[model samples]
Target chain A: MKFNLKKMLTTFILFFCSIAFLLPFVWMLSTSMKIEADVFKFPIEWIPSRWNFVSNYQEVWFGDHPFYLYYWNSIKVAVITTLLSVVVSALAAYGFSKVKFRASAWLFLIVLATYMVPPQASLVPQFILYRYIGLFDSHLGLILLGSFSVLGTFMLRQFFMGIHNDFIDAAKIDGAGHWRIFWKISLPIVKPAVATYAILRFIWTWNDYQNPLIFLRTDALYTIQLAMQKFTTINGSFYTLIMAAAVSAILPLLIVFILGQKHVIDGIALGGVKG
Target chain B: MPSNPSIETKTNIRKKQKNASKRRETIAGFLFVTPMLIGVSVIVLFPIVATFILAFADWKFVQSIDNLKWVGFQNFQGLWEDEKFIKSVINNAVFMLTVPTTMIISLVLAILIDKYTYFKSYFKVAFFMPYISSVVAIAVVWQVLFHPSQGPINQVLMSFGIENPPTWISDPNFALLSVMIIHIWISIGFNLIVYIAGLQSIPKELYEAADMDGANAWHKFSNITFPVISPTSFFLLITGIIATFKVFDLIAVLTQGGPLNSTTMLVWHLYDMAFLNLEIGYASAIAVVLFLIVFTITILQWISQKKWVNY
Candidate 1:
């Protein structure tokens, strides 16, 4: 095949743009591993001259603040939220799509309408309600608030709707109940969609800053994002340690994205097209 | 007589069983969504109604419930006269300029990457990395990078013989711009993935047909590719507007609406009003205004889609 000049030029341009996009992350890792003295070196090192990985990470993880505690809190909240959200959304999606109940269409519309309501609109009132209900500064509050995602239900319902009615009819004839059919037959078929939603929900919860920032006050119950802010505020001059903390905060989700790149990308595309 | 009686009894039993099963199914359906309904009521629906009501009240954090003053339209009137609220609205509009910049860059990257069969996923992942990471973490990295004295960005600028580079994230003139730059960078990856999918979905036959008609690259792109991907573009545009309008995390982390409050967008302003100043009623007014803006834009987008979007 003949090489096309225009194609080559565009490829080179994209290659450079990709580097520019990835440069901050590269710099993040480089800074995270650098000693304080080497961090401000004029040459802007891509690789640290002196590897301070162990000490930097140690300080971030085991320093004056409870970084490890925050990490665990974040993990607990994210995991619980993801699981509850997936299950609730899946059930709701199944009910909306498969069950021939009265008022189902209206109920589904209500769910869809709620998707358009920005969380910030309800934030202050929610804060008051949480405080009144004794859920203030608690991980449970965050989990409960995040557990029911209208977007997840809407997306999954689309997938659930695509499953042929014949499957449900056959299950009904076989003396199967709605729950059995949902758990045993239809859900299995839509496993990929469910998994995609689950991964997206997990990442979203893990990266969430606003909810934890506003809801949780106590430092011990702080999520990693909240703790990072506290750490930065207290040790603002310790650039090396802050970068190390930043890396620790983001590394898990980055690993998740790497492992499930297809799901994350496809889920985003699905959301875009469907919307 | 005996055969008829037995048949009637059998039919009655079958009917009763069927009715019982129908009841069970209905109960199961309700049970399935019970948790979500409770969550929506307590967390989403009730709070929304309360926010609407609270917007008109004169409730302060220090005041008791019985001491609350019901001042209809007063909070909203206050918001109208508030300079900070006006500044935030303008800042939000200025910040929205990132949407188009992000879209153009994402579209160009998508097209370029779509042309190449090699390392496509690599480029896509690289662009998407920032989006997947935490905003606080990303913002911190940017803060370090944009440091006025020691940050590599200013260092590079000085090396290129551009003297006296502005203090990004610290200077009022450049802080909002700095935040916008980061926003654009973070959003490009997600938009690129979406656009690539849209580009891929455009039928190959259209391009082949255009080639047969002796259409040039620009002609084919304008007549075929652009129209076909209009829906995706429209989706991105609407969501981007809504998301950027409510931008809080980046500002909260990086600038905290500092350097003369130049970067204070709608949500950040609301946050400061409610959480910092303990002005719940006033903040609710801001929230209501924000909701109205987002809701209106969304409805407008839906109504206008038929005019431009192909599908």
Candidate 2:
């Protein structure tokens, strides 16, 4: 009876904490659909008395800075970056893990060491180099900045190490080259790990504010994050509109989270176990 | 004699083929890693070298390479005297307190949800929502929620008989704290999930043995749970401290180093100096310091891991 009561009490406390934790997002959703006047109605209207959902969303999606353009930009950058990064990291991971070479260990160690250098340390020089190379203020430069991740290579390498050598050896005995073995024999086995990484890379690239904020000078090339900031600044006074913009900015992430929750949880678990 | 010569040549050919195949594999390995190697060399490694070099020099990026002026230790001296830089460093140290606070809360919640709660996934998703959301969006929502008089938080406080609630994000005194609150909130989901993972890894036999021994929950937790999860705590701590230094989006979106520079963190200060003030040399110096601090922290953590972390 005591144990049952204790479980009930803990659950009861957690339930309320969860509500308070989700209050910001809930309030955001509610306020976005609310009319401006109903926004400040004290003893707060959890549900809006007057709904302005259509017009509020319409204004945000097609306002002076059309969010659709920014959305497209973010999608293009994130997709390309994730695809390129995954391919690059996976190939390198395969090489370091499966391919026998004299200097493989040392080279991988060098790559791991570079991961310790903070990105902030290199921002200034990267800015200068991009300008010098005529890649400044372009999506290509921004994509290239995130295209190679030492962490991704190192992470995928760990997964690749788990692949049995007999598989690769059998493929080699059949006259299969390293490339063929990597594509046919090894990658499929680590598809889940790769997918998890791809999702994470996409989300990180999509939400990335600093690179886009620094690299992209043209307003049209702005990602959703920068556009969201600008939208909030212009629509600061209209709480309803700002809330609507905020909702739009995070809607895609929420969708991704819903879809990839299991993978994300597993990835965090992998990290913890490895630690 | 003839049979011996033919056999020796046959073995020699096989050895040569083996060496040739080994060489081929090595070449293929090199080819596989070439792209990543080039990308890292150009994007990451080269830039770090440039940052270190540029830290000792004065030159706006607009200026040509010939215009570079080397001044030994001058940028570091500027950092030593700069009030904003000093305060930003201090603010970052204060901001790091959020990591431990968030970890403790997440741990307790994780233990409850992992063992006691009914709907585990429901709780996990709810907590994690803030973490996955864009910082700009979250910061904007928080701006509304932290509104001086009209916000829900102040409204709740005022209703409870506190006449004046501190205007969070606007007041320099509370700006860092407000940001830290949001930081803690966003971090809980990730930390909670990780702690739950760490918790599940603990062997059930140990807990069962403790139960058999009539060991209380507190004693079991202290003797077993806490020590086992110390590695997770250490991992989170290192990453969390590194992350605190890299906090720019929050500052950029919410306070912009604020009414009194109270929330001016290291990265925000670096951004301000590099981009806004066009003090590239000074900013590079700041980045160098940031790098050293992270390096020192990681090294210290590794050394101290011997004492606390179990595995």
Candidate 3:
């Protein structure tokens, strides 16, 4: 454990670099709280000149647009999607891991293959289908679109397969059904994986811009990402206000990651791609 | 022999336990999985097959299913002659070099952070924070940061006696580069995490052995570190490249294929044709071309894995 000066110097610089990486976000947060006059203050104030920060949020919440509509839409879509995706993935993962069937592998491959198709590739067809089904511009429709993902199913299957057979066999011997075994024995053990998948799906669905952009025509149905996209105009730009909106949109994701970090870290650690 | 009392009691109990639970498992499994299965079939699965077939058909609104006419290779011909489409393909090639270079450097940064013991998660969180945020939000912020005049970046440069920083978003020469910078910045977290994970997988014993052999940090890295992470790097390379090729949202939010269509990547081109111009047949063709390009490159990388992606 000799003290290597080169290593120390590099690490020292990297620490500040990492901080510098965070500087834009810091600046955004500070600027949002600053008075409109101090928005471009020289010497770069890292904190606000003003103590109170309400008018901006006040406008967002109660403006003619009422961004809370966007907020509510985002929450509804994200929650429904996360729950649907997780349950479906968990069930499918358990099936693939435990069930016997002639065409299971083929079916699973088809599922994974769906991930390879770029969403852009399916844009027209999905639009046609949603339009036909009368699900267009509806919240339930948006939820269903975001919820189904093959990647989640594929990722969860690996975790379920890692669960040992002894517990499953014991459950069976005790007359526990597949549902009970899946719920009690399998689900609890693979909770880390389930939690990780949930966080990812939630973040992705929340941050999704493309789907909402295309499917959501009505102003009432806009997600936060879509709202933030339409914030900028060619003339009379509101850079500070948009930055404020941006920060608000990202805050929830930060919260989710903070709460789920341990489970996520364990999940990544289990994958062991680094080794 | 025992068909009376003993057989009757045993038969009843066995039927209840076996059939009851097994029957419940079959029905419950299907019920639990139905939502995803139905969603995937309609939204995801059927779309793939439908889009491919629709690629050959000539339709404007694509509303009347009966009005679709089979126009084999006609749409592809139009896209080939499209000057805008041609420019998009060329732009994609230029973008390819810029994003990957940034990915490599950030990976090095991630590895450095991994080696240092202090502030690991803090650094991880810092590097990864940008990733979880909204792409549209980040793009909008960067749009201001790279503003032509009255922007901090140029202002700081002028303070250092440098002058005339290009208008990043508006300048044709810098527009694609500006997008590339954002792409790289946004991507660093995921790539860093992947690289850091790859780095951690390398055993300490190899470094210990290298130490006994009088090997320095560079020596150990070239031999021990590089080979071990090749698989993860390979994974990132294919996935990142594919992701870059298919990039859309940020470009849509930031430039909209600015000043003179200099920033018109293929996805934007395809999107414009269909939605803006209402040319479904031609747009479908462009999408198919994009798919071919991505699929071919992915397969090439997959093939090269035997040689370069050592695992």
Candidate 4:
């Protein structure tokens, strides 16, 4: 088959643009592997002449900066946040979608409306509240803060609504209660949606800089994002080390994105279409 | 005929069971939502209300609730008189310029990729990489790239015979602009995906009919594609504006709103006042102002969407 000229031209243009877009990431990897002097080489080394990958990554990982501690903290916070938020949101979504109770509609509206209030608006009060409750500067505090999301509830509810009521009605006839039906029937159907929201939540919490920045004071409790900020400030002159740290920081999410590209893309699409 | 007493008793028992089950359902519903309700109250709702109240009262981080002085709009008045606050607001407005630029670029990219079946997924993932990455990582990478003396960007500019290039992130003249560029880069991925979704939803028959009417590419796009995608555009427009207005992580990581506070947007200003300065009341006022700006714009968009955003 003959190639269409317009299609070829579009492909060529898109290819070039994609390279331009991915160049920063490429540069990041390159700089991360280069020795100190070669980092600022004028010709822009796409590949370093001397690979310092082992030493650079080692310095970041095993160096005095406590990168491993921050990594563990981030992982712990993200995992707990994702799991709890997903369960809480899924339950709330099910309640709103399937269960009939007094003031349910009004309650759901309140939750949805709160999603519109930017988190920054509530920052000061939350800071004070956390301080008063003795939860300040704690991982549990960060996890709790990230656990409940109205957006998650709203998104999952849309998925739950798509489920036909016949399954629910049939389950009800079999003497299954709301909780049983929610767990045995409805939850299975909306598992993909739940997973989508979970991944998004994990990524959000892992990458979150604001909450940790405001809430955590001690270096020991710092999340990776906060740690990166501190690391950059303290070792600003070491470009290779900073880039190595940056790579280490983003590697997990990048792996997730690569492995679950379809899910991430679908999640984004779901968000757009639903909104 | 006389009614059977046993049957009547059985019917009454069944009615009681039904009521009991109904009560169980209500209890279960409440049980499922209770945790989330508690969370919303403690984390979101209470704080929002508290922030509003705090905005009217003069308080400090060091003070207790008992020492809270009721200043009633004094914080707002102070914010109005503050030069830094005014400059930050203007910076936020200027930062909003990224929304349109991002939309146009992403829409074009989406259109180009949408036409080709091959490499579509590849392009999608490539573009979206930056969006999923941590803001700190992206900021640091860009900071290196924006390095005045030895960065690739300046090096490229100098190779083209430009002796002097503006120092990004450090130069007051170009710090906001530099941040805008980074913002646009990181945002294009999300916008591209959304636009692609929007473009894919447009019915093919419209395009077929337009082709039959001898419509050219521009004509077809302007008449058919543009109007059809207006809802998606409107959605992205509102969301993009809100997201950009809340841009603190990037500022904090990259420029720290530095080089004479040229990059100090609303949320950063709020952070500085509340977290850095410990002026709780003033920060609350800034938060309220930011919320009002977002709320008003969203409401306005909702009201005006009917005029041009075709269903």
Candidate 5:
């Protein structure tokens, strides 16, 4: 009975805390569906009495600063960046781990050292270089900014190092070259780790606000983050509309979290175990 | 055994073939890493070298490189008298408090869920939801919640018989605190999930032995759980402090370091100088300071971890 009481008490406490934790999101969803007058109504309406869901959403999606364009821009930039970086990082990882060379360790240490330097510290030079190179204010500039991550390369290298040297030796004996072994043997062994990194890369790119904020100047080229900020700034008074915009911005992440929960969990676990 | 000319020739040929393949492997390895090398050199490494050099020179984005003039410690010297810069540094120091607070709360909740809760994954997902959401979206929602008059947070406060509740996000005295609250809220889930992972990695036998010794919950936790998870704490601490210095999105979306520049962080201050005021040299100085701060803190944390952290 005492054990049952303790478990019940702990569950109740955690359950309440979870509710509080989720309240903002839940409130966001609720307020998005509410009418303007109903939004600030006292006693806190958990469920909207007067639903303005369609119009609020339509105003956000089809009205000024059309979210669809930003969504498309974000999708394009994030997808291309993630795919390019993953491939580059994976190749670099395989080379550093599987292929033996004299300068390999020294080169990798340089790369790892760069990871210690925060990206914020290098913004000015990057901005200037981009302008000089005529790539400023372009999606290509934004894409290239995140296309290579030192952290990604370093992380994937650890996983690649886990693959047994025997596999590489056997592949070489079978007349397979380094590239063939990387694609066929080593990569397959680390697919889950690669996938985890790719998912993280995609999410990080998708949620990135800084790169897009600084690099892209044109409103036409704005990603969802830029669009969301602009939308909130202009519609500061319209609580319902702003909430709608917020929901629209976060919905995709929720979908991604739902779909890739296992991978995400595994990724966090990988990070923990790595330490 | 008699030396055979054909056997000796065959062995020589095999040695040459091995040498050739080794050369090929080295070339292939270089080829594989070429893209990453180029990208890092251009995007990351080159820019770092420039940031350091630019700190002593005065230049704007629109100006040509020939127009760049050396200012020689003027930028760094100016930072000493810059009130906003000083405030930003102090605000960032205040923001660092979120790390330990988040870690402690997450550790407690992690223990509760790991040891007692039934719906483990559900709880994990709930806490992690905000962490994964876009900062822009999350900040926008919080802007509404921090609404002085009609927001739910103040409304609850008002209901409890307080006549005047301090306006959050707008009041300079409370603005930094408000941002910190949101940051702590967003961070708890991530720390919680990581702590849970850390908790699971603790050896079961340790807990079993504690139970055999008739040790209480707090005793087991302090002696076993805390020490065992010290390495995890150290990891989170380092990464979390690094993250605190990089806090830009929230300030950009929510406050823009506004209401008397109370919420200004190092990154935000640097950004304002570089982009808004067109003071590239001054901003680079700020960036260099930011880098030195992070470098120093990380080294300090790494050194201190040896005192408390278990292998």
Candidate 6:
């Protein structure tokens, strides 16, 4: 219970560091909601003196070039990709963790080895393949590309191992099939992990700029990030508006993290070394 | 780690499950990973193989498809002569050195937070706040902060009587480092949390034993702490190197490899080559090089883990 000066110094340094880390975000949020005049004043304001939330959010959401479609497109892609990734990765994790087959080890190694392949190496051929198949610029193409996550599969596999295998055996003796063992028993044990991965996957896909930016042609088909970039224009006149757009895009992610961060931290703390 | 007693008790049932179950399970395993296998094959694996094939050919990507200039060894042979790809590789090497320095700093900070009990969770959450938020947002905020005119960063410098700070993201000199700074800030939260876990996993008895030997804090750290946590350091280094190699988002936003391509690394160059110039064949060659570099390094790290990593 003693208050040591060393602990006090550590706490103080951390507080300053946190302030330093959090201030830019605080500045961006304030700037996005401020009047253009207030944005560039000599003395930077951390908070908008007058609240301009309604207009800022409005311009970002329903301006001359509305972000509504972009919002829907991003959300749609993220949701579908998350669902597909979760289902596939959970199954893959289960197979790697629970299913006993002669080929299981090899299959698991292939999956693990696949993670080592960098995605940029795939860009050119995937583009050509998509173009040939006429999946280019299509939402389905984006979803298809985004749906597979080897990292997610590997991460979930680690979690499934942490689960007690007795449940799997108990279910097998009840005449449960492989599917039933996965669905009824294994699924419940790894729900926290699944949820953890889903959050990470959702953030990853939502923030993804490259794939959609390349494949998507129409401004209306844009994700929020791309749409915001277009909204700001390449020339950068609408920089303040760009900040507003950035703020709106980041808002949802911040919410997701604040809500789910405990799980992610716990999962990472427990999960990283083993992997 | 669990055994089914029924597999021992009921031989006939076990044999039936084994025979029929073998086919059923194989099919099920394939079915389970079908989406990932298909998705990964189309988007990742197959494309990679195709890139290697395209390296030896000359497809204009969007142009004439029929006539492929069979340039055997020319593309790769051309790589050594090319300046930009070479520069891109060099920039990547510089980046590789700088990025890990940032992550190491974070690891130290995380250990400090962990060693002190009070408000550890609060510090952990605060440190990680930037990571969960959008990278684009962070870049934009950073652009403003690095603004030569009124940014708090240069502003503080100016107040200290430092004149004419280099224009970050605008000057070719500091652009790559500027981008790395933002990357460090974003990735610190992640690396810090990982190390805190590493610190916790170390046995308290080691420190207790060291204390009985009248070891100072520094001695205890070097003796018991660093070795125990070296595995986490190893993981961070490998992941850091890989992530640095594939880094694209921030560069595409902040500098666009501008200030005259000083910040352009392998993946960014690949993006420019493929999407910008439509030189798919050449870009494929470049991507093929990156894949080889990254894949080789990852394997080497995995092999070397035995020397340092404990658990």
What's the CA RMSD for each of the models?
Answer: 2.0, 1.4, 3.6, 1.7, 1.6, 4.4
lDDT of 5 by residue, A1-275 (tens): 89878888888888998998889999999999999998888899999999999999999999978999999999999999999999999999988988898799999888887887889999999998998899999999999999888878888899988888998899889999898999988888899888888888888998999999999999999999999999988997998999999999899888988789888887886686565
Q: Candidate 5 or 6, higher lDDT?
A: 5
Residue A2 lDDT (model 1): 50
Give the TM-score of chain A, superposed on the true chain A, for all candidates in the order listed.
0.96, 0.97, 0.91, 0.97, 0.97, 0.92
After best superposition, candidate 2 residue B229: deviation in angstroms?
1.2
For every model shown, what is its TM-score relative to the native structure?
0.96, 0.98, 0.91, 0.97, 0.97, 0.94
Off by over 4 Å in 5: B1-11, B301-308
lDDT, each prediction = 0.89, 0.91, 0.78, 0.91, 0.91, 0.81
Q: Write the per-residue lDDT of candidate 1 for residues B1-311, one digit (tens) a residue.
A: 78998999899999999887777767887887777777777788888888999998888777788878889999999987988889999998998899999999999888888876357898889899989999999999999999998789999999999899999999999999999999999999899999999999988998999999999989988998888898999999989999998788999999888889898888999999999999989999999999899889989997898887787
Per-residue CA lDDT of model 6 for B231-266, tens digit only, reads 888888888888898788898878887788899888
The residue-level lDDT of candidate 2 at B243 comes to 83
Task: Tell me the DockQ of each model, to 2 decimals.
Answer: 0.71, 0.79, 0.47, 0.77, 0.79, 0.64
**Given candidate 5, what's the lDDT at residue A92?**
95
What is the full ranking by TM-score, best candidate first? 2, 5, 4, 1, 6, 3
Candidate 4 pairs with clashing backbones: none
State which docking tier applies to candidate 5. medium
On TM-score, the stronger of 1 and 2 is 2
How many steric overlaps does candidate 4 have?
0
Name model 4 segments beyond 4 Å from true.
A1-5, B1-18
By lDDT, the better pick of 3 and 4 is 4
Give the 10-residue window scoring lowest on summed lDDT in candidate 2 chain B.
B59-68
